[model samples]
Target: MKIGELSRTTGVSIRSLRYYEQQGLITSVRQPNGYREYTLLTIETVETVKLYLNLGLTTEQIASFLTCVLQNKEAFCTEVMPVYRKKLAEIERQIVELNQIKANLIDRIAFLGQQEQGNDE
Candidate 1:
């Protein structure tokens, strides 16, 4: 199939598909007319890429172990553990920071409410 067909089949835009190719996350063959041709198997790879991206994995990170995942050899993709741990740590840190910000905002709002009550007295 051609690039358009792949995009339609995968529900990913042509631009993004090209970007995936450029990132070496996916691949295609150049036809004689300069059009790109893709294999049916590429559909699975694209879906896998989408899954990883939704999990907050970057293309660079996905590339490290995508082949292992596609081949159903995830247990052998040791690189996935470090990346998953790193991403989880980052998310945890952000959650802590956001909690702090939320607490501060709540305190500020209460203080403002107290001042408003005093002014009304």
Candidate 2:
């Protein structure tokens, strides 16, 4: 398939796909005619890339995970678990901070409402 097919199938933009190639997140072979040739596996690889990217993993981190998985499937599964666990912990902390901000906004709204009612009296 061509890059357009990959983009259409993966729902990723062509620019993103090109960037992924530039970032070393993906690879393509060139034919004698200078056209980029992609394998059938490219589709699945793009999907995996999207999944890891959405999980907050950088391209380098995703590459490390891919290398580890290719080298040692079992240990990769075991060792990489903790990294994701840490990401989840950080997300939890962010959620807590966001919740506090939300509560502060609610309190400010209530205070402003009270002041408005006071002005009417």
Candidate 3:
């Protein structure tokens, strides 16, 4: 299929597909007419890229995992575990920070309520 067909199949925009190719997350062959020809597998590849992006993985990170997966699906787990662990730790840290912010917001709300009540009294 062509780039347009791949984009339609994957529901990804043409610009994003081009960016993915530029980032080495995906690839395509150029036809004689200067059009990009994509294999059927490109659909799944694009979906995987999208999934990784949604998981907060950068294009560079996705490229590493994609390289491993393409090289050997069996080796993917062993090779990608460290990346996953690191990302998980980052997410955990963000969660902790967000929880602290939430607590502060709640405290402020409570303090404002108490002040309002005191003013009424």
Candidate 4:
């Protein structure tokens, strides 16, 4: 199919599809007329890319294991384990930081509320 059809089918923008091609996350063939051609399998590849992006993995990271995933060998792909672990660790750290910020905000709000009540007296 053409780039447009791929874009519509994947719900991804044409520019993004082009970028994906550039990033080596997907591939296409160039016609003599300069238009790009994509395989039907590119659809599944694009979807996998989207899934990884949604999971907060970079295209570089996904590029490493995408082929393994496409082959249905993700569990056997040891390289993917470290990537998943690293991302999970990062998210856990962010969650801790956010929780601390939430606690501080709650304390500040309570303090300000008390001050307001004192002023109203």
Each candidate's number of clashing pairs is 0, 0, 0, 0
Query: Higher-lDDT candidate among 2 and 4?
Result: 4
For residues 1-121, could you state the per-residue lDDT of candidate 1 as single tens digits?
9999999999999999999999998889899999999998899999999999999999999998998888877777888899999999999999999999999999999999999999999
Per-residue lDDT over 1-121 for candidate 3, one digit per residue giving the tens place of the 0 to 100 score: 9988897899999999999999988889999999999998888889888888998988998887786676677354575777788999999999999999999999999999999999999
Provide the global lDDT of candidate 4 against the true structure.
Answer: 0.95
Clashing pairs in 2: none
Instruction: Give candidate 4 regions above 4 Å deviation.
Output: none
Model 2, residue 45: displacement in angstroms?
0.5
34: Cα error in model 4, Å: 1.0
TM-score of each: 0.90, 0.83, 0.88, 0.95
Better of 3 and 4 by TM-score: 4
Per lDDT, the best of the predicted structures is 4
Badly placed stretches (over 4 Å) of model 3 are: 74-77
Ranking by TM-score: 4, 1, 3, 2
- Candidate 4 lDDT tens digits, 1-121: 9999999999999999999999999989999999999999999999989999999999999999998889976788888999999999999999999999999999999999999999999
Residue pairs clashing, model 4: none
Model 1 spans > 4 angstroms off: none
lDDT of 2 by residue, 46-114 (tens): 887888889997777677576455456636466578767878898999999999999999999999999
